[model samples]
Target: MAQRADISVTWERWQATPDGQTARLFHLTNRRGTRLTVSDWGATLTSFKLAMPNDNLRQLVLGCDTLEDYLQSPYLGATVGRYANRIRGAKFSVDGQQYKLIANEGENCLHGGEIGFAHQLWDAEIIESIPAVRFTLHSPDGDEGFPGNAIVTVTYTLSEDNNIRIDYEATVDKACPFNLTNHSYFNLDGVAGDVGNHVAQINANQYLPVDSESLPDGSPVSVEQTAFDFRTAKAFNQDWRKIVSDQRYRGFDHCFILDQNDGSQPVAQVRSGDEQVVLSLYTTSPAVQLYTGQYLEGTRGHNELVYQNRDGFCLETQYMPDQPNSDCAEECIVRPERPFKHSTTFAFHC
Candidate 1:
């Protein structure tokens, strides 16, 4: 069995960090009996348990059992920001001024910096009216070498219809790169099996190709005849090994430009092999990055399960990777005058 959930919508102190701050957890339940657990540590969605048709509950996302496990985990269920994906060569020019960022992934930066918003402690509030946890963080100017004081807010709300909605809003004092997204690895079959048989359909006709280093090639390419095509529903592992067999490539790390997106319609849909559950992803963002967790190597997870490669998959809805360097059509810059607002929802159903 997976970790039991607290049915009561209560906020409790989960752990006391050595740094003197407290990590809190807020448990939320919807009218349909779906439960969601969020942590204040990174504004992370720790657990998303859906009530199965068989009258049982199943944990749908990959998460850690403890705060310690989350500290060691690689961006699992965390709200990553300042910037979400790669920044290209650890540098980008904003308003004719070139800024150098911390390089955490080889010579390139990945998910903010060496110490990103992912590991930061956020101020949490449980809104009684909506049954949501609102997390706010203030990033001072020059934090992680970024050139602006950014005030960011992320809210996790569990709707009565079993949709896990994430609302992100941010404002920066100066023009800077601001792409925020949740990095939650989802496996509809719980954490017991791989996601090979998971059926996925993405509403995208083109995808952003990448270079050898996994940086965007500054343009978009058609997904036709390529394994990157998920425009139609198909088994996830179908032709997966043949696509990523070279070992130099991680599976499905490319970004798919959402088709006919106006932020209201779902951009992608995924289902378990047994057809027991279906997850619909709706986002305001123009693109969704599909990563198959090709490098998921860890010893600990829910139920003490050792997570292996391809055990989970991430549907990170965001602008695009290396936004500043790429020629993506969407605007990735957020400034004081023009704030950034984006929302993503994962609607789960059986």
Candidate 2:
């Protein structure tokens, strides 16, 4: 782990809202020529710079200008948690006991309730370079209508192999539900427009469908007859716009139960236009939430302001949501004694 003082740490004030909430940006760059910009506001990774095979220059992640835009930008390279996805009814039962969570996403608790990990000022330190800058935060018992005081650590590592690896570890003092994921809206083509043209493939045969409120129901179903079949390279927009009338989301936003024999396996691989960019995902988490930026509103990224169902996408790695209260979970990860550890690496290639 990289230590706080080992790397050059610099801080800059981004902006302050009229309500007194302010956003601070922290820059952590290392001797390896890697640069990472994170905001204390949400423990959010505002910018990630990396070298491209085509050019010696570093590239900026999908990002927008302005603090309001930064805060509003759900995909501004941030690790969201406590519980990353939705829990049905804003309540779940664990160990025969009932617990009510903060209902932020309609009738459900989406992403650790309203003030999920994305909306916090995390305490951070650069662990002196074993290869990560660890961001730590304490989620007090019942902070978001959930239980337990959980200590969470999210480590960002820029490996020498040109891989950006994210390692998450958390431990709760009590039994509660927890799932974490990074909500980075990716536009492999640099926000030109619509991932409809990109080729993608997921190693999942079945996926969990949700009700109108985006809550997963019952067991995993085959993606066979539906537009969810992503077992091989398929265009995101090709099937995204073809969802039936009954589906609530305009685009894809569902969890695909992964076939993990040993955890941390390749769940999906994405290829951009012209095969200029290739991205692969590896995770230990039981599920991966594939979102096509269906509800992405406003401007950002390389080409133009992102519109609904426009540029950008997400592949979240984590356990099944609503697992705390439902038996529908493929794997219930939250435990009192075991240390919850999840590692996801995004390998970028030409």
- Among these predicted structures, which one has the highest TM-score? 1
List residue ranges in candidate 2 displaced over 4 A.
1-34, 56-60, 246-250, 261-265, 299-308, 328-330
TM-score of each: 0.94, 0.87
Q: State which candidate has the highest lDDT.
A: 1
Q: What would the per-residue lDDT of candidate 2 be over residues 56-115, giving only the tens digit for each residue?
A: 434435665565676666646677878888777888776677788788777888788787
Q: lDDT values of the candidates?
A: 0.85, 0.72
* lDDT digits (tens) for residues 60-85 of candidate 1: 98988878888888789999988898
| Steric clash pairs (candidate 1) | none
RMSD of each: 3.8, 3.3
**Candidate 1 accuracy as TM-score:** 0.94
